[model samples]
Target: MDKHRNLDCKDIEAITALLSKDGEALNYYKTNGAESVGHAFMIANLLHLHANVSEASLFYRHAFNLHGKSQTEYPLPQSLLQVSLLCLLKAGQPVPEEEIKELEKYAPSYANYIRGILIAWRGGDVKEAMSLIGNAFEGFHSGEEIDALYLEIALKYFPALTAPITDTSYSPIPRHLYMYWDKNPPKEIADNIKYHQELLGEDFTFFNQENAEEWLFEHFGSETLSLFQNTKHPAESADFLRLHVILNNGGWWLDADLRLKSLEQWEMLSRLPKNCRFFITEKFLIHNDFFGTVANDPILANALLTCYVNMLKHHGLYIPYKTGPGVFSRAVSRTVYSSFNHDAPLPSLAIGTAWEMFSIVEEFEVTYKSGGNWHTA
Candidate 1:
């Protein structure tokens, strides 16, 4: 397993298959020495990436327990503890009171962060939870591990603190689906596109590198087009492209590798309330990959402006913060928080649950594994 540390999606699929056979992986780890704690942590990450939240939580807990009993220090105890709690929360399982006490003992600030999430999860006061989370963020120094964790956790749980809207008068998102890829995509991505086209018929639009550039130039003119061209990676360019296309055309924007799980998921989309924008929140933050919106949505408008400013002002910033989920989540956080500050009605934004999002689409990510992953590039 150590040799397979750099596992790809195929490796993960294979391991998942092996683990599914009568809890073989779990039993093996139980019989093995505590030194396998690091391996358990790695396996937990793989499971989490593949959306096996329950199994990931179990493994994360196992790693946390094993690390406590071991002398090895590779998987920092604080990191393990944080991930364990987060995975448990994401899996919809109760974090044991003992674990909470443990977290409070070693990391009281993070304990407060978890408590804030628990309060929101348990339908407590929204303002109080927000205050606790905000204070937790202040306690962490910028660029620390906890800083990113705090941002992600706040983004995921903050919207839940807001009151639900009863109005439903906005226009429904267009049934159209838009996706993009390079001129020559891998067979897997191409097949995924074909599946969507078959499902959506004329409502599906596929954009390759050339056509996306053309569309950008046509809709946004040369300035935005140049910004698109200047992106350091295909994924970064995609971040710019999705915002512009959805802002102009108003439709579902799905990543090229995404495939709908079933027709039921399509029907679910149709049933979504006619909000100005619809987004799916994953484990930590609002994912940029799959979302829907009307043309010229203010949320997307803010996101686009943020991306542009990041590109021009903060050259060499990390991709996530520059043009990915980081900026998108911040846009959402701002919108929600600003509404509260002004005591105004919250925007008609619909956020799909992680369960709903996973039920709707699965990633057949072959290109990323074959060195085309922009994050790695």
Candidate 2:
């Protein structure tokens, strides 16, 4: 199950059947009394992949209990416990005191981190929760999953703590709009681009495979050029490009598929306060796909710096944490925390309520005659 193969419908059906109560695999295990902690853990992972969070949480708990009671010589994998705790948290299920105590016995720092997230989720002391989360970043050598999860928890629960102090002294984000595609874009994407151009007129700039590299080389030099070239997917490359472009040019970076919901939304963008970075929050995570900021904004700088650092340390790891939303969210958190603690001068960051104001064309609605989905790539 850990093997890296793209799951097709048949594979999904088989896995679903195996986990079903009346299915042959589950029935056989039940009849033979052959269930093991390892098997249950596998079931939990499958459930998680299928997005059955509640069911996955139960399976993870079952695995944890089984591991504790079994006589197997192999020590329990720490990840099983950690992921179980995360699954429970994400499912909005209660974590037993005994389970938390067990986690504390094994990894005290991580236990504290989990407790911090729980505190924030439950609307306890905001300052204390932020402090614990900040400390957890320092205490643990977290993997990409942990980093992403931590950022999501912090942003979702303590958004105010992660927003930068507004400095009205800078300059307003320019009305310019930027978007990119790897090659010849599909009709839907092209249509969306045209629509934005109709709104912004000559302020709109589109980058493609031919001109995007030249632009990167001219603005950022060879190292950035090399990094852009080495990106594992078109989406990752776009992630790298958008940050640099916005940092240097100071304008709105819109995904190719995005368009304004109405003229009112366009007016809304125009009405945003000057010298402040603007972003939309969907489900508490700050989206990088469509953000506007002044040139050389520290938040954008930090996000780009994070991308470089993650690439150097964990090249080609998870894209979101490596160069996408995960790292961007961290940059926002760090900037806000620094301002709060040190009273540093920084631009005010505005987080809008929802992304629905700007419509995103669903991937399914477009036929990709050229470059296909970047994730699968």
77-175: candidate 1 lDDT, tens digit per residue: 655676677777777877777776776776677777777777767777766666565545433322223334443444444554322545434347777
How well is each residue in 274-351 modelled by candidate 2, as lDDT tens digits? 544445454456677787888888888888888888777878567866788767776766765665456565445666
In order, candidate lDDTs are: 0.69, 0.66
Residue 26 local lDDT, model 2: 47
- Native-referenced Cα lDDT, model 1: 0.69
- TM-score of each model, in listed order: 0.61, 0.73
Worst 10 residues of 1 by lDDT: 1-10
Worst 10 residues of 2 by lDDT: 1-10
Model 2 global lDDT (CA atoms, 0 to 1): 0.66
**Candidate of highest TM-score:** 2
- Clash-forming residue pairs, model 2: 166-348, 167-348
Best by lDDT: 1
